[model samples]
Target: MSMKSTVPSAQPDQFVHDHLPPPEQWPELRFDRPELEMPAQVNAVQALFQRAQQAGHAGRPLLRSDERTLSYAQAQSEVNRIANVLTVDLGLVPGNRVLLRGGNSVAMALAWLATVQAGLVAVATMPLLRAKELAAIIAKAQPAAALCDVKLQDELKAALAADAATAGLKLLVFNTGGAEVPHSLEKMAARQCEHSTPCPTAATDIALLAFTSGTTGTPKAAVHTHRDVLAACETWPRHVLRATPDDIVMGSPPLAFTFGLGGLLVFPMWAGASVYFPSIPYTPEAMVQLIGRVGATICYTAPTFYRQMAAFAQQHGIGKLRISVSAGEGLPDATRQLWKQATGLEMLDGIGATEMFHIFISSPPESVRRGAIGRVVPGYEARVVGEDGQELPRGQVGKLAVIGPTGCKYLDEPRQTQYVKAGWNYPGDAFSQDADGYFFYQARTDDMIITAGYNVAGPEVEAALLQHPAVAECGVVGRPDDERGQVVLAYVVLKPGEAAGAPLVKALQDHVKQTLAPYKYPRDVVFVSQLPRTETGKLQRFALRQQAMQTPSRNPTT
Candidate 1:
């Protein structure tokens, strides 16, 4: 399976292009839609910069911190300088991978944008990733250079020392607090020109390798291109988000995740909007305070964060906040209602995957429904399909299948078959569609709890449990049972000052039974201080299931 290219790539290093999955393995990319059309030569970062200028926002705020703001003109100048530093100072060519390790800050965003602008593939790692995790990514991606925040360099330094593949990595540090340190990106950039030529990359050339956060198992890098990134902006932002230039965006998802990459950075740039980077990692109280302090218009984070921020937002005020986005996990109806009650703004919920780049299915803020994640985004087609790839009835739960401008393209992994099949991406989400085309999330395809021949969705049960005042967070999984096979079990974190005892457990069970079918109620409840979650804030049900394995259910017959 060979691909014949019509557009010439500017990439000098051919490593990424050579290692791409076979032509047949790529989920079919559709660019037939008028909005999806683009020039053969495209650099996503350059396009974003151009978009801001065309929208008459060159002098407007583009990046913000608590104490400072960078106008679009200033930001573009810095980005160009960094691109020059990457290609000139580091002696790297287009298509070389540059590993980026930082949080959601102006420095991290500039490094990522500059890497892509230079035609280099940016492999951005999570800020909180440990030495072992960093070592695994280094071994897999084998980046030729790294641009890391000085504050978070210890773990990466430890990882580089232990991994043979990092021996050749040329490292530069950013956010040095003006220290004249050697190998400082800021120092190199200052000596470089304030302008650099945008790499003449093909629209099809790789832009970034977004590795899955490894919530389920081993991390897999999902490949996206310049065309793919721009096309997604046309679909989700143009159709659903509709961000204006005046909007100031803030979020908790690290830029390493595509969710943050799009919501907090790319989409904002496309809309000629600015993004705020909190001076510190956001706690619920801090996030609420900063949103008001910065007058953030749109905010993005997981549903759990929304649930935690609701009380703080109600007390301190959400400021100029207009749009609240919930993703990374299913938005429980309880959290949705609670936030709406607190902020009077409907949460703009969406369902997307790292493989797809960004949200492909989300309702416009105007047409939000209680349980639905909205209709398929424009430029894409979606269906609810069964095991045999046949479309299931409108009301029945089935695997969610989607095909659009962007789809799954793993980096030489056998699991490619498991993600992309027959030209569609099965993002491992189970969903049911209504006659009106609205889709309701069931759970992760693997998160469905089977109890006594009846299937239960964990999110549905968690949503019900969250309705109880004492319940804070919960993860539901299937526990092995002696009599009825697997039974539904819940690991719950109760609110502060709430007693966790048999009576509270009974009350929680009764609440679920009242909220849903009695059979779907948790047969066993384990109280814990907190549920296991990935950095992206997705519940780690596999860990919970393993924890369940260690403690048998005692064959509880409810």
Candidate 2:
């Protein structure tokens, strides 16, 4: 689509784009490091762990217990045993998709890797998923069977039986207690390992079926190929993170989301570093404790998580986390500053969508701008286009569009066109570029709350309120107002010792006013126990908006 503009001179020439990086800064592979390439064979499972057999058997991959450590040899043997049963006994085929439900554990990791190796698409999900949500996902993506931990299997079975759509699906329970199962994964593994050759699949073959967090609407599946998944392991650690093999990586995003998959699985494995996966409840305090216990060097999390971590770090001490990154949601400036002060590490803000599979724009540690989402990565193109489909000038806010090899194709959904335009994909985010070519996140174009004639992004007000010490968590949304068309309303969760009343409400309102333009301050404040979140830990602002609409008089009177 050709766009006309007052911005002809604004678009940098392709030559300018090419020369932006110094020749010396170009990626150089270490002689001893494995080559990073999109494999000629496209199978996702094979592309990632193709070397696991040799690596696993030669020396066991490191596994940490609650108090002890397990060797790499032990891990691979267990994973290989599971793979054999999945392929030989269950007749799990290359094309079949298997749903995996469990928290982070050695078994969950083995199940995911084995499913991929056996040529099955792994649909890993959060253990906290409610029955209703699980029913919707199961109906949308009918799996051949489910592999669940025994503890959670009863609830999963009940949820499956309660939903007519998932009745015929088979279930295989794996007791995480390390005991033998007669017909379970361990039992199947005791049989002969498969000697059959794997059917070669292309790099573009779908390896994973990851669902969106569904903070706003029904979750859509983001299909990722073996190549796309491997590309993240290859590109991100070098381009965005630059972590060494010795770095101990840890973070709090669930593995089901690509955010977690990249940090907790791919990045650490590619670097030959150890990744610590905490299976317990992840409060900010617990995260700080984990880092201290593990001597973690790289930490990945959302901006909200960063703020809480920073708060704990200020009161206590955050261990030596040399590299910290934030994505899954926008990083507020306050959180960024707090983390920097606490950890002495710049918090790299990344912007990625489920459709893209992983982060495409993020700050490299050395080149971070205080309030930007960094530059586009190599092999990707990003642009801001106006309503008329013309490219917008730097410093002008417009729809952010992107085109890359890993761009999205929704699973049989008509609204795919709504997010994909002329081969570019956009998840409805509005962004602006500065003259220096840094992208600044604005509101989602559809989510901009227009009050009178002013356009207010809900995130902007929420970020402002979060800067206050008394605020624990908050959501800002537009509530219908007869005279003003829409008024800003804030749902706030106060800190543990903070009181909830008109005084606190007024202080929050005044706090936002002091932090930002007065027009963006919340006119109404409702104290709540907690803000709603989707399974993937993203805030549910749309749900809060609905709640605000339902309770007309719930807004506190100042």
Candidate 3:
């Protein structure tokens, strides 16, 4: 199969300019032409919600939960029910921040759509984020209200109550299974008249405020407008995924992650396609079963998940898989080979960020390069630059910077200046582009370990290890893993009486595994007296890297 471009490929000079304008002063670049065919619709939420309503009136659109399926009309009526409560009951305004804490379920989708359709900002967060992390995010976003799953309601209440800065944030739980929680969405919507007035919003208005980890200490909110969402839904589908209305897209990543949100929800709704959202967290075997049961044609997930799916499919064949897309982290060469061997489908590698709102560079089904992240999308621009900000020649690895319709707009955070500079956004990644225009991911400019498709900050893991009862101090770095590409490695200075041995190493590993995602657990743990540091007290991470290299591989056989 071959992919033919309708337009001439853009040149590297197209990405560089003598002067770059700030957001307000961006005077329509020469590239902004009618040729671009940007979607007339504004935000993804507004457009999709409106379509869902239209589908309901036509008696065609249907949404299914594990419990039941609702027609388009039924789902629209439910959105109205919740929107009315937010407007009339809670007195939330258009720009009010409403933090959504949940997973990839129909109820979560409904809540997100309802919040945006009501003209409020929806900040969706991962369910697995710890209390401290959530509190840090809450403090920054300063939500007027929080819509959380009942399962996490008690923990959230405790976390917020313990934090003095979150005193004014209100809580509303989803209470899925009729949990013993007050002020559930179910209870509130039932009390309402089952209809709420629609609050119209402009496409330029802020509809989504998604929180993503920053190079700095805490996570920062990336504010995106209705325009950004629609742009992502349209461009990504047309150029990369190339999904049709007949395609049933399925994946393992949670909706909180941008990859899942765009591919799973917006893409389907935009094309009038059917989507299947699993009620439970995705296991490889569970995903195989779902795909076979739903007859899903297109699947969107990370390279790690795809590899696991390949392993699962080998044992129990995936009947109707047409295309599988991989993103969220670098796609290793081995994973790509294994996936192709097992499924006979090329894993479309893409490199995206919360900053760009969705994928900017991805391999179209026909033009996939097995080990590369692929060329820039039709409507975006990308370049590799040196430290002094000069464009690096093709084939030379350098800092990867991006500028496109969907760029970063940090919400009230000064770090915005650090990320978005001179009209180009750098998400702290190192990459290179070949003469043929294929992009290859190198590593994070920061010391973040992308293991099993999760960004694990080396410092964050080091902080977690320091809390262990037997550990006096620790330094964490990522070591290369054959499967994960990188695994967290910890060098610890055990507390005086704690001897260095297998039991102590095992205990430290167990402690970190319990503290964070088990995948981020330190595979190599070395007990030491002290870590080498400079006069200013920066732990010499390069030295730790050498120590990690001397340590044997801890990756399990694939």
Candidate 4:
């Protein structure tokens, strides 16, 4: 029963091995469909490009923005050029980790495809990450090199400079627009060959290292294989999303998030569809304007964004939109109904995680139930299990256990045992199954908070607060709210001289907003003299939660 690496690759870098869970914990991966079977030596990039070519849509648009549109053929060429630079120019061998930092842009997509094509694992980080946060990931993943947007290189540079672990990290910036920036990926790629062959990687070769805040509140890398990426495309988009070649997809989630990566890039490419990336991050109002202007047929975003944009969509008319997808958080009945009334499009609700890679349970518009999360996707199976890991009877709330083609493979973290047990991935969510096989949500089993569809780890927020000069101690917890389902609330013990008032509270809130994702900012700050701790000196988060629940509510704006 000892944990050991079951499958080792022929590549020089075996960093993935140091972090893989034991073979027995891995889900029983199956490929019953002929389309799902991949060759021993396969590159997911090659398969995606070949799919577009075989569909005879090489000339069709694959990526679109206000500035320009890239055809499938053109996109492939770009990918090949970047791949060439990664291998020939940079001397990046197979299995090397390439950290990618950027928003959802055409250049970012090209870099991601190039990394995979070159047989290197891609570690995509959100653009919102500050230097300290980036430093932690850098120390954990130890990526040899990075490809970043030129505009977003400051924090990454600072991170590398501050952390000795990233001392020699090489950075390649893109979207430099002929600026005299040295080592620009776009500039180097232009001179490289546009016909490099894809790396002869095994189907099971690691393709990505996605970082997720595990139950312990530390960032843990989730290992995903080339086959896993292909399988995701085969299931969700093929069965549920059902995007067609003619559909133009657009969304607000950054490509760094798996949901965004799958929804904005992988799914569209699988169907030979086009995806639109805004020149900048779109506000709720801006997203509606772009949807109307671009004539986007399929939309993907979180529940809160949908609620905020419903009126805008109604006033402006979203006539061209045929499908609206919601995930990242629970979709309230009110938000779903508002979107339906506004756009006449039923919001398809689903539950997914960075561990599974994509949605495993989702309903098509025709089979949707008001409160249920819907049936498991064709390639997956699920059940609710009690604390003892025994299957619970129908309609009983318990831990949600799932097994599918893809499952949790935490990179070299002890939490792997916690997430994967007896070949099933426990996603830390409480749920119940109905007689009809639909799954209904209950609550999160951990201290993580889902605010506006973004998973905010309470400990991560607490760590961020401790970094500020004003904080002596802190505990972060989720407070339930009607608008966002849950909002982050921080209980802080300020420094002796620091005042506890609206001004200091606002300062702490702004500090977190700047330090982490803006959505993770504490909506309410309660000043405390000290935090409750057990005899072992462990902060009693449950005690703090009880206090948070009893505190009088305040307007988030205040």
Question: Which lDDT values do the candidates have, in the order given?
Answer: 0.90, 0.71, 0.71, 0.83
Residue 82 lDDT in model 1? Answer: 98
Best by TM-score: 1
Instruction: Please tell me which predicted candidate would have the highest lDDT against the true structure.
Output: 1
Consecutive 10-residue window with the lowest summed lDDT within model 2: 2-11
**Residue by residue across 432-521, what tens digits does model 2's lDDT show?**
999888888877776678888788888888788878989888888888888778888888888899989878878888888888888888
Listed per candidate, the RMSD to the true structure in angstroms reads 1.7, 8.8, 11.4, 9.9
Candidate 2 accuracy as TM-score: 0.88
In candidate 3, what are the lDDT values of residues 309-353, reduced to their tens digit?
Answer: 777888788889898888776666666777888878777778788
Candidate 1: RMSD to truth: 1.7
Model 3 stretches with alpha carbons more than 4 Å out? 1-43, 51-62, 164-168, 179-181, 193-195, 213-217, 447-558
Ranking by lDDT: 1, 4, 2, 3
lDDT of 4 by residue, 1-558 (tens): 111223446357888866687777776665666556566666788889999999998999999988889999999999999999988888889899999999889999999999999899999998878899888888888898999999989999999999776777789999887898899998899998779888877778889988863223566888898888998998878898899999999997778778888999999999999999999677778888888899999998877578679879988888588999998766656567878999888888898988999898999999998778789988888899998999999998788999877889988778888888888889887788999999987656677788889877776677667668787667888988788888888999887799888888888888888988888889988898987753212356677777878886653564
Which candidate do you rate higher for lDDT, 1 or 4?
1
Error of 2 at 420 (Å): 0.7
Sliding window of 10 residues with minimal summed lDDT for model 3: 9-18
Deviating ranges (above 4 Å) for candidate 2: 1-37, 50-63, 67-74, 163-168, 179-182, 192-198, 553-558
My TM-score estimates for the predictions, one after another, are 0.98, 0.88, 0.75, 0.81
